[model samples]
Target chain A: MRTHSAIAEPGAIRWTLTAFAVAFLALFVALPVASVFLQAFEHGPGAYLAALTDPEALSAIRLTLVAAALSVPLNTVFGVTAAWLIAKYDFAGRGVLLTLIDLPFAVSPVIAGLIFVLLFGAHGLLGPLLSRHEVRVIFAVPGIVLATTFVTFPFVVREVLPILESQGSDQEEAAVTLGASGLTVFFRVTLPRIKWGLLYGVILCNARAMGEFGAVSVVSGHIRGETNTMPLHVEILYNEYNFVGAFAVASLLALLALATLLAKRLLGDGSHGGQGQPGASQEAR
Target chain B: MSVTVRNLTKRFTASAGSPRAPAVADASFEAPDGAITTLLGPSGSGKTTVLRAIAGLEQPDSGTILLDGVDCTAIPARRRGVGFVFQGYALFAHMSVRDNIAFGLQVRKMPRKEIAERVDELLSLVQLEGLGARYPKQLSGGQQQRVAFARALATRPRVLLLDEPFGALDAQVRVELRSWLQRLHAQTHVTTLLVTHDQEEALELSQHVVLMRAGRIEQVGTPHDLYDHPSTPFVASFIGGATVLRGRVEGTRAAIGPLSVAAPDGALEGAGLQAFVRPHDVRIARATDQSAVSLGKIEKLVRVGGFVKVELRLPSGEAMTVQMAKTELDALGVAEGDRVLVDLLAAKVFVEDYSI
Candidate 1:
């Protein structure tokens, strides 16, 4: 049988486009990251350790980690619940809910942060009430966490919704008929099926939460010891003319982004995994 | 457990651009304990709908389903103690064979040890003991079907329902599984209702066959009764491909196309009526020079199995078929273009007005 091999289209345009794309990516993406790392190592290993242990940089790293940890689980739970409702049920106002969930993604992060400020700032709506209640939202840890969460919320839902849709409702119904209670069926059958997708969603959410800057900057107030995250610290150091410290913080965030890329590769994008007993290979594809 | 469905009526409202077709209407039958009752019909014949209604997967407009004399109409599918093997086998793809079978037990909050023991028992019972670690996707089509059966039975339901269980399998697998299913049913003695459009399967496996058509039960009886003594013209034609011949009646004797048949019961609604004849019961005779035996000409002869299906055109230009055995065919030496005669022997006749 003569098969139409895709390899047969080894045209000049294909090779040219492939070369052009590789060259373009290397020049635009790979070079800048390599320069950052190369500069980070310009100082001796002792200077690198001293810069890493800087009190201001340490606080920023701790704040970013705390915010990401808080936001990732919250986003995960919200994403799974929303995805389940949208994918599994037919109800009124469903399209509106989906639009609202995706609205954060479409809207500018700066605008989103400004909206939170307008609602929680001193002269804004609910501002006086919050002050009287001593409930601080802007210029606080909650503000930074909330901003990051809003920007990162859609990652999990977007990744899991289509997976839930294609997995179908038959197996779950079969479990129900087998005398399994609702919770048991979810843990035993439904979770195993959706776990890989859920993990992918979580990884994306974590990456977004860790890297979020525009929204957090608008609300975080950038207090040195209290609220400044790594992105805000990087900007502060750059404005203060400490190029090495600024690049160092940026390098750490870049590393987190790199980790996310590696995670995605290992998991095979949730769809490419040899359909295993769902959660058995959660570490990788 | 025996299941009795009475006065079941379900009317499906017309969905855009199509006529309002009732999936099930006024259907009723009893599947006794330890017996396989098959609801046999064509694709749109409401057999599966009736089965699902009994399994509580479908909520009928009005009906009462009784399991062992207890009315279970209001009960949900989970509480009804009914196991359903879906057509597609709907196994949990994530779970291994052992885990799939143990799911119901684990949900019931059984002890961990008990769950494992019962899972093992089910695995061996389904003849999948060695493949306990395999996922549903890893198994062959037949093995997956057996796992599905085991998963359904692990709940220890009172009655088991299978909806076209072997429809997804190949012909050889289907036949092999049909015998295995029959043996499994015998060993477990669980009253089962299997819905199938395959008449051969229904005839071979079921103790009681319920033939349905157009949202109504055509006839319900033993397989022998349905095959041999069909009550309606539809049943006669649908069950075994019995051809109908229009005839004129005069008392007990009826004049068919170039032939005459005498009704044993001498029942008649009108002078003109229809006669039913099984192809196997009809005989073909070659023309003899001395005296031609019921003159006819063979229009087409199709060899099937050990018999040849002969479509003969009578002197009156009407066609009738006869299933002649290989030995009889060899002796008669009938060919497609040969001129012959057809003899109708002991064929049941019904009134033409009640044809459908």
Candidate 2:
């Protein structure tokens, strides 16, 4: 059987448009990312190594890793729970629930940080209670983690929702009929079916959690050794006229983004891996 | 185990202040032990819903599901000990045939050795012995269906439920799988209930047939009983390809478009009725024959495999279909636009005043 091409054969205008897109990506995205590594290594490998292992840089790396480690898994759990509730069952306010899950995506990250500050700041709502309890949330590691979680909240849920919705409830129903408990059905049947999409979501969530800048900056007090995350550390270094040091840390974030892209390619947009076809997996169920 | 359901009813509320008709309204039937009983109907006839309820996949608003004389209506699906095969096979695409078959046993935490042995046994039983290493996508449609059956049978539940198991396959594979299912049922003797909309499939594979219409059990009997002695006009027309003709009954006879046929027993006299006659029961002959009951013109002749379906229009403009052997049709030399006489060999008449 013959299939239609997704786009018609390239005319002069189409070729011109394609060339313009390629040039735009190269100039805006590729060059800037390339310059991060290029400028970081301009002082040679020794300086680059020194800048990476610098005390402040190391602490920022540790703080960023710690924040990502705390936030990604928490958001992943939330994402799966939210997706399961939204996709597997229907109830009143289902549409409203979906829109709420997507609220993080629509809200600006800086605004997300501001909202948290309003709740946890020294004089904001609940601030007095928190202060009375002698526990600090704003301008601390906890605040950084919370802000990062807020910014990356929608990644896993969005990725897993469509896959779960397409999968239907047949496999889970079959598992129940076959005498598998609810947990067993989820771990054995439901998890395996959505593993690729879930992984894709987690990868994106991890990327956002690691690279988050604006939100972490607002909540993180930028106390060098205590609460400075990688993005905040990069700002500190750049403002201190340590250009190579700043680019070196930025290089790591760029590498993380590259790794995420590589993982997405390997997973094939969550559609090609695993069963490769929605109907095929449905048939198996 | 013998499975019986009483007064199974399920209703879906479409939205606030608007309730849709029940999917299965007061459906009750008994599937005998160690026999294949088929719930047969068109889509939305509640056949699949009844099967799902028996499997405990769908909770009934009010019903008692008795399995081997035990009340299991409130039991959850996982504890009901019933194996359900979905219409689309529902195989785990990520698992090989062996692992797929072993899933149920593994879930029950059966010993590894025992799980392997049982998987192998099922693989051989389904005639998919060597293909156990292949993924579901690597196999053909028929192979995947067999794997699904094997997986469902792995746990050896008291009852096996199949919901249009062959509904996804093509014609040739559907026929092959139907016979395969029959053989499997015979060997297992596991008291199976199958749901299908195909009349021929239900007739060919089932020992007992439950005919359903609009969420109600229309009739329940053996395939032969349902086919030969349908209790309702729906059953009579649904079980076989029957042409329903509108007419008025006079005593024991029904007059339809210049022809008269014996009315079904208990049909009211002097009342408008619908006569249900199988296509093959409508005999056709040359119009010149004096023994002919009614005269009509052959509108079209459709050859379907070994038999030809003849479309005829009566003088009163009522359309009727007659099935005849190809050789018999050839011998009669009938063609489109030719006038012919049709004889109603057998018919079942019911009062047409009532709505289904």
For every model in order, the TM-score on chain A comes to: 0.91, 0.90
What candidate 1 gets wrong by more than 4 Å, as runs, is: A1-7, A10-21, A42-52, A114-132, A221-226, A239-241, A269-285, B9-22, B111-117, B231-234, B244-256, B259-277, B289-297, B312-321, B346-356
Q: List the candidate 2 regions with Cα displacement exceeding 4 Å.
A: A1-21, A266-285, B15-17, B264-269, B289-293, B354-356
Per-candidate clashes come to 0, 4
Pick the lDDT winner.
2
Q: Which candidate's TM-score is highest?
A: 2
Span of ten consecutive residues with least summed lDDT in model 1 chain A: A276-285
Per-residue error (Å), model 1, residue B301: 2.7
For candidate 1 chain B, the 10 contiguous residues with the lowest summed lDDT are B12-21
Instruction: Report the TM-score measured on chain A for model 1.
Output: 0.91
* A1-285 per-residue lDDT for model 2 (tens digits): 656588865478789989999999999999999999999999999999999999988999999999999998998899899899988777788889888888888988889899989999998998999999988999988899999988999998888888888878888888888888989888988887878778878888999898898888888888988899888999999999999999999998899889988987766644553644442343221
